[model samples]
Target: MACVLEAPLRMSVLSEVTASSRHYVDRLFDLDPQKVLQGVIDMKNAVIGNNKQKANLIVLGAVPRLLYLLQQETSSTELRTECAVVLGSLAMGTENNVKSLLDCHIIPALLQGLLSPDLKFIEACLRCLRTIFISPVTPEDLLYTDGTVISHLMALLSRSPYTQEYICQIFSHCCKGPDHQTILFNHGAVQNIAHLLVSTSYKVRMQALKCFSVLAFENPQVSMTLVNVSVDGELLPQIFVKMLQRDKPIEMQLTSAKCLILTTLPCLVRMCSKDRLLEERVEGAETLAYLIETDVELQRMASITDHLIVMLADYFKYPSSVSAITDIKRLDHDLKHAHELRQAAFKLYASLGANDEDIRKKPILESGAIELLCSLTQSENLALRVNGIWALMNMAFQAEQKIKSDILRGLSTEQLFQLLSDSDVNVLMKTLGLLRNLLSTRPHIDHIMSTHGKQIMQAVTLILEGEHNIEVKEQTLCILANIADGTTAKELIMTNDDILQKIKYYMSHSNAKLQLAAMFCISNLIWNEEEGKKPSLLMHRQVTILIKKLLLNSNICSAQCIGIQSVMGNIILGVVWIVGVVRRHEEDAESSLGETQGHSDNKQELERHRGGFHL
Candidate 1:
């Protein structure tokens, strides 16, 4: 009886434990919606607390569930926001997690959240969108369909500085395609971005500039739109220039520089249209000139625009007048405008002539640019004169023979001669460079020598004897060399005692460049002549010293080796010519003496024959 009672109690205890275990299993797998959301929140918190939890959550299907919660219309804002945040966090997680988020098609829902009024929700959505857009695997067309997503984001640009910054960044990514750039522009992105350029927030302004940069980069239509907007408002261009100023942050300045090249430059090129205001055209040309000076690509791009040449010529034809200014401020402003206009015009002219000889001739000369440049070279304003001569120099550098002839004929010999006496050293240097280019060609050499040869020689002599910059001295020496290239010019240079003394003086100077230039000048004087007819360059003591110095210097390593070698070779040839001349002179003297003695002997023989006939 005792054993039977113990067995029944054990069975009851086993049944009660089985019922409790089944109830606990049901509770663990509860399907309650609130319970499911709470569980998700806990997982999100865990993922946030420990980034390592993201991989675990991804493995457990958290991405799809969060995306589903975002798709639910009745989902609370908090829940939807949390879902977006969690999705964004996961997107920011591992590469696999991003792949998981993308696979769930979360972009549309996040874009919907962009329409939400709550800034945090919008920010979370933007973060998610930004990450998705930045991924290489994300299809470009994913966010773009009928332009709705881009339109919505552009609408959000006016919300807050933070929102504007994020929206601009998103647009920057979207603008990777021409179609996307067109869509963005169609939806007032250009106007919006132009306004954002003046935003009080530096971050917003930076992002806005970057958006403009991306949109305008290689997109001519968008660049034109931004430029038009800038012209109508006159604010955007100023903002661009302001950002480029030294006072702005370096980052802002750098971004501004890029915008100036990729956007402002193209816009300025287009703005060269004839109907544009004179002030607007001048500003555009000035900006282009400033940019092309620092970048070769810009120079090439700017040169191709045929209208820019026309517009610049038009401005040169009728430049802004400061003559009527009575007020001091107006006078100052007019003076500044005149200076900038002249500088920009000349620089653009130089850039256009950099490679193409046709550009140097057809458009420039047709537009009367040569006449304006010639006139400006004589301007009382030093800046005008400097830039004018500089433009002429670029025009003449490596120019075709025809182009050089055109330049010489366009600028009178007297004007060019007067430029040689300009008080400004820069003016003098550029004038010499132009003269060198002109004198390099055979046709222009006669005009230069006949008209201004004496004055040029005198000016060069003065500059050489005076205390001037080494560069100026070197350029003067080059001009002298070019002058000596022609037979007439060479004779004139050789006969001038003062110029010869100057050349000899520079040959012995401590500055190696001056010495080299002098050697070059001397070598040209005696090059390609008959044996005994070459000028006696070897007669000067400085020439001997220079030869020895060059021989010694050639043995040493130097950056100037090739140039030095060429000069040394020319000098050696000159020396050999001199030696040949000396030998030819000696042989001629011996032949003459032989003839004289033979003639004397013949005369005595004739006289003896006559006396024998008489006997």
Candidate 2:
């Protein structure tokens, strides 16, 4: 073993061996892969003496064989280290196949590789572990499974000099899975990571801070726990003060700034709740909001959320906690930090709220943010107005009492109701979108009914009556459909003498979209044949208009045909009612005046004169 480990193999031999292995895997499928694997391993042992060339050959050419060998054998310390180099190479290579090599026992082998006396081997294994642990997949419930993954990772991180960097990288990868990250935190990853902030290597310190930031931002529980451990108990500020004095590396400074931001966003959320973290929450928000506003948007956006999510996932993986600590200097000497960075970050953060699902507040608040959002409802930018309305809706649903008054205060029953009258199709579309969400909340529904319901109905009725835009008209009908159970709008649209005339105009429009929408709107209103109370004269006129148009228009396609057919069905119902009325009139006249009404005087006469013969 010593001679094999000590012998300096020729570079040509190593190259030829590695090439042969690649050929076997890449082209010579007929070759025994086991023999190719053994040859690669033998060459790895012989080439160990030459660090530079050997590591490259093992990594670049022999990785597939090495991975295959890992499954076939209980790797010895030397073999394991060599295989780790190959794994690390594969990770760094174009073929990203290392994620599939998860092992229930690989952790111990990695630990053994980390302890190997060969410096090259140790470096390679450390790199390999860094790659392996970054897997985004929530390694299945390891309780009866791979729990050893975290334990073994912790053991190596505890002993490895690059512990901080490794954990940071792993956590960075873990940020993709919030639940899995929390699990890592439960296993003492947080405190161990925090210690690295004071490391001699600036790279290590930066990485540690980054991992902490990820944990603190993405997982609220971890954020709260971090606040308890670092801010409430006073651990973070001390580090901040110390960092201020040190000539920290640029990367380290950047990481610290990011960690500061990560810690602040969630802490601010908690602070908004008035908990024990009230002070820390306030301080953190002020700090982070400042950072976002003053820092470069690109840099902050790149890391703040990403890092926070990673740590969140790790903490979810393991929920262990150490003693709580908080640090405070009690002065507003906030660092002017990165000015351009802040401005860019703040704008980006504000923009992100539009896409962030977690910011689940109503579009209106009883008194707070919902009210603020509602105030912005009149913003000239359609996107802003839409987003503002959406935010208010979410707020109203999430914090009904908090946002109820704000919605009321911002727009009067009439003015707020008049918003439903906005000319912008997108604005109306968004309002309906907001209403759709608000209707989901019981109190919100009741509030809408109590405060703005009638006014809203009036506005919607006008749009349904005369709106020229097909999109607005269609969405308006849909909104009515959503609120159909309790409103008089449906009855008015179905039986109102004048509204029925407007619907007939739409049915006759040259635009098929308008015709289709009109058909749909009329169909929705005529749900259950309740028009028996109203006279059928206006309904008969509408039926006459549509039937005559359909029969004369041979160029109409199936969509129009279907719409006309639907209109025909409703018209037929109206025609039947009209026939009943005309027949009654004829009978009454015959009884009282002894005269019969002429068949030529029928409403169908008008339909026939209008060319209503075709189907």
Candidate 3:
């Protein structure tokens, strides 16, 4: 060998990686891991060398060693930061094995590092928390106790813009869990969010708003707290007004709109009583109503209306005992500024009968609202048609008996015959629904069934037999339950040859949605009782088959499982109820023949029980 010479050039601590340096790292990894670890230490010293090299070393079973280096008081500040970065990456990665942090007081030391004079150290701590938060499970207690994370974060942000930006990102990720969210809210997180609205950095504001949106999702009370803060005049309006004045980002605008829709609607209704809301109220009311009307591209309007109508009807039906609305005059008050709502309701009804221009030309044709709705079998949109039928249903229930009669007039034998043969299954299904209601009342049912009994029965048979749409089948099933009140219907359906096969076909249908609907129909059909025998022998057999099928499907949720149990339980109860009813009927018949017998209280109890079933 030539004269032995030591390598004269050692890598400087601040040297950054170049193409040759990267090649050197590659060779070190391939040739020897001892050399790679040496390289990692050198890179950590060299602010100039590969930061990636230090992080990569941790992935390969070196994270615990790196973290140990970070904890040593003698370690260089730069080296400690590099080690933390590597550890952070390891904790975030799928292959991390450094669980020994539990034994070492690493969390307290990391919190100390977060306050380091070196910016790199603070950045590294933020990154560490970020990585830890991404894990499926988070260790909250350690971070909360040592970091005192939220309080320290607020204090740091009050001092500097750059610090605020970094803290917002960390807080956004940390406050994702509901427990953390409650902690944040309890410790002035809402005010912190509001403070960031005017943040100098775009990223900081965005992150802060994102955090606020998540917190507000199931916690409208947070939004209420935000609104209650004394930042602006009359918080709700001020928020929207300020939103329009500023060049708001689209995401912020969307978030504001969603939060406002949820929190503000109820607030606005409450505010309606105040003189301030009434003064110059029409313009504001129209604007808000238009926004609600257009929200979700019109899908939510019908749902909203459904809720309001049901509330109104329930209140009308049972005032104090079952009041759906506590304030009787709210609708009247809303009507003052909500001319649009009144017009919209009329327009909604109009659409049921309208072709194209006929809609705009007339307030929906109420003269034959029911008949025209029945005829919308030709409409292509099934949802619209179904809704039309539902609207007619609500209209029929209007307190005015005239409205109900006008609906019934069109459901005569001739009209029903045409409806029964319509190609659109929903038309026939809805028609049957109307007929069921008409027949449920005194005099009319027996009258209609006697004249159009055979045809109406045939129509009912067709829907039960031939309808394929699950929704149509469900409606048809409910209609059958309504009409299946007497011996005539019972005999007709049981005797019909096609009926059993159709029921069997529905029971065997492969589609889950269809199966559920069919099951519900079958459940309702046999839910009632005949005398003391309980469920008829025929009904018991069908229910047993259903129970067997339901038990086999373990994928079902507890709610659906409970529903199945309820139906089965009711079926069993129905049998017992029927037995009791038969015994009571026999007892009454026997008592009528007795010379002297009176049990007025027993008769009254039976009457009350019978009253429970009438509606």
Candidate 4:
């Protein structure tokens, strides 16, 4: 045991894996079926206990031969069955491992391998297919592109208890998105999956319910369809509602919430609109608004149905903080409910305007949601502050120039600047995102940056230099990119040497997204199609050395090299040279650093390039 642990993992893999290049891997073509079956069982036993064994076995090229064994017509049922079992064991590893198995067409092989009179082979094939389909990155689109895949899978839904459970799991994982949902619903998966809700097996019942949630995710049509399907004299939605009670298992209740999102919408929307007291109406709005706040499609549907957005807007009566509540003791529940309702309303406002530009700038803007959001950006409550800032950010996305001005004005210059350095990183990042969106158009960006240009740069510099994560810094660089796009704002950015230095440092960052963002900012700051701007002599000397170093290492891909070439031409030569470098200063700058410092700086530069572009 001690010696086994000491040996290298690669060499220590089971003899079945590395005995020869084609020992176990090529056993599928052997003339003796009994020998092939025995070999498959040995491999499965060796790989069953650990994922590393499975991964190593796959890396040693066991998947293709095992799949070939399962696909053989002349192979005996016992041989094919054990082949499926061994292949399923190999399928249980990282996404990359499963992706490798899939590249050999395991899905169709498993499906076609199920055609047999033997029950064990069918069970083995179903189990193997389920394992492959369970991967998050499985090519679900491949299942439908073949046209017969769903029909073939549906055929096994009622094969037996084992097939039922495995098939349901496969469907749960495969019904990933809207297109899959549409296809499955059209093929009568709703009735079959709903039938399992009353299944005697607890696992079957649970798997079917989970499958309902996957089908209903983001696809409102499936949710509504499930609501109408009657199972055992109870509507499917009614059965799930009962499952939500405390008497049911916790897992069932959670699954019920996911599957019943659409069915519960109309009731909550109506509850918000009934002629009730102000408090009750606010409670109803809070419940309904919170439900759809995180789902953009649900938000759009709710806003378009039953006057939902208008009803939600009525509850947005500003915040209920210590400043406004004169008698805290007297107005405890009422004020608390009001505050909860306002936060929910803020979230829904953000959701509603998330994708729809007209809704963002029009109704949300017209209903004073923007003003209420701005007021709460400075609130003492963290949830209220972040939600308010988030709502304003969504409203500013792709907004018109006038709408951008109104959002910025309503947010006020003082509050916007303060939120940029908010102690909560969530607030800080959302505020930065909001700033990027506000700088959408060149005209409006120039106008805002002209007035608050210096403060913006200072805030960005503080965030970049601080201990923020790569995401926050990436966003900061994005705002700089936006500012640099404007002719007027570019002047302020160009003057800040610190900002320029940060941009240059990020150009060599290990993270390609950060590198691309940094490169874009520098490019925008120096690029001028009309006047054809050039980098200053000092900046030119620095950036050119970095570019030449990048060229030497061949670290970036063809795409990145092409993108950076434009930035380089502007800095040094106009059209005749490598980068976008200007022609006039080529001779003088070449003698200074462009060509002179290329050698010393190459050795002095930090090792930044990791590998090929993953951007």
State which candidate has the highest lDDT: 4
Q: How does residue 449 of candidate 4 score in lDDT? A: 92
TM-score of every prediction relative to native:
0.56, 0.43, 0.43, 0.48
lDDT of the structure predicted as candidate 4: 0.70
lDDT of 2 by residue, 288-340 (tens): 44444433342234234423322212211121222222322211121222222
- Report RMSD for candidate 1: 17.2
Q: What is the lDDT for 462 in model 2?
A: 75
For candidate 2, what is the lDDT?
A: 0.48
Per-model root-mean-square deviation over C-alphas: 17.2, 14.7, 18.1, 15.3
For all candidates in order, the CA lDDT equals 0.67, 0.48, 0.48, 0.70
Better of 2 and 4 by TM-score: 4
Tens digits of per-residue lDDT for model 3, 1-615? 111111221133114335544543343334354554555555444333444443334222244455556666766676677667655654553322223333344456677776676777777776676556545455555556643667776766665555666666666666556677677788787776667656667776666666666665545456556556544334543554454434887876776666555445434322322243333333333343344443332223222321322221221121223244466575456534343332233334433222222321222332334555555433454554555555555444312344445565655556556665666765566655655555554344445455556776677676666635766765665554444444344444445546544654555565444444444544444433444322232433443444444444443323544544444443334334334444454567455323122333433343344311111
Residues 3-104 of candidate 1 have per-residue lDDT tens digits of: 111244334434444332333223323467566556556555656745445655554445665776776777766767777777776667655556666666
Better of 1 and 4 by TM-score: 1
Model 1: pairs clashing at backbone N, Cα or C within 3 Å: none
Error of 3 at 235 (Å): 5.1
Q: For each predicted model, how many residue pairs clash, with residues at least 3 apart or on different chains?
A: 0, 68, 12, 13
